[model samples]
Target: MAELRTLARPYAKAAFKAAQEHEQLAEWSQVLTIAGQVTANKSIRQLLANPGLEEQKKAELILEVAEDGVTEQVRNFFAVLAENRRLTLLPEISALFNTYRADLERTVDIEVTAAFELTDEQQQKLAQALSTKLERKVSLAASMDKSLIGGAIIRTGDLVIDASVRGKLTKLADALGS
Candidate 1:
């Protein structure tokens, strides 16, 4: 996993930079996302792995599948990836590109798991608090997790605030056992 990310970083960064310079971040994001999804299809993966398929043919197939989303810049980008045999890294590249785009837009997506459904007011308050805390626009993805028992667990990027009742109870149990 780490190795793939390491190899994908340069390509992702290059794509991000080009998109930023051209003021086409949204278009590039869409292109990468569509291309990534296309490559992840079972048949597409098999074709990509087939040694008999030419690199140009593989690139063409991907572009054809993502016809609506491809631009000239994206086409060239795919060509470069194909030529370098880094096509398998599309998923990682797309993910990293999204991270870069979010950072540039000063936005962050946070997942909030609570014991019960959150009210609109509750979600609004949480978003406001997180926006204030992170100095970024907060987009909440709320879900119910009955196992939480009570309270909520918030996750954003690498940070997690496990304030759920189940989590506290488990922590207490561990402390007592220790």
Candidate 2:
């Protein structure tokens, strides 16, 4: 999976550059979403892997499935992938493209899971707090997870702040051990 990401990064960067050059963030995002959805569906997976079908036929099926959202440029891009047998990288490309988009927009998605449901005030405050810490606009999604026991866990990128009772107990145990 990591190696696939490394291989897909260049393609993703090139796609992002092209999209940025054309001011096509929304367009590319939509295209990638559609492509990712299609690629992830079991039917599409079977189709992509079907050996009985010819390569051109498989490529045509992909284009057909993607017709609603794909523009001419995207179709051409898909054609290149079809020729190169790189269509399986759509999922990785979709993901990396989003990473670039977030970087360009200076935005991050933050997930906050609390033991109990957060009030509107709490949610807004948390978003504000995280925005300050991250120094970027935060797109926050908060939810209740009783398994957390108490408090909340905040995750953004590689940084995680665990303020739950469970987390504190573990931390205290580690502190005592060390």
The top-ranked prediction according to TM-score is 1
User: In candidate 2, which residue pairs clash?
Assistant: none
Off by over 4 Å in 2: none
Best by lDDT: 1
Tell me the tens digit of each residue's lDDT in model 1 across 1-178.
Answer: 9999999999999999989888999989988898889887888888899999999889998888676757788888889999999898898999999999999999999999999999999999999999999999999999999989999999999999999999999999999999
Give TM-scores for every candidate, taking all chains together and pairing residue i with residue i.
Answer: 0.96, 0.90
lDDT of 2 by residue, 108-166 (tens): 99999999999999889988988898888999999889988899999877889999998
Q: In model 1, how large is the Cα lDDT of residue 129?
A: 98
Pairs with backbone N, CA or C atoms under 3 Å apart (clashes), candidate 1:
none
Candidate lDDT (C-alpha), each: 0.92, 0.83
Candidate 1 residues lying further than 4 Å off, grouped into runs, are none
TM-score of 1: 0.96
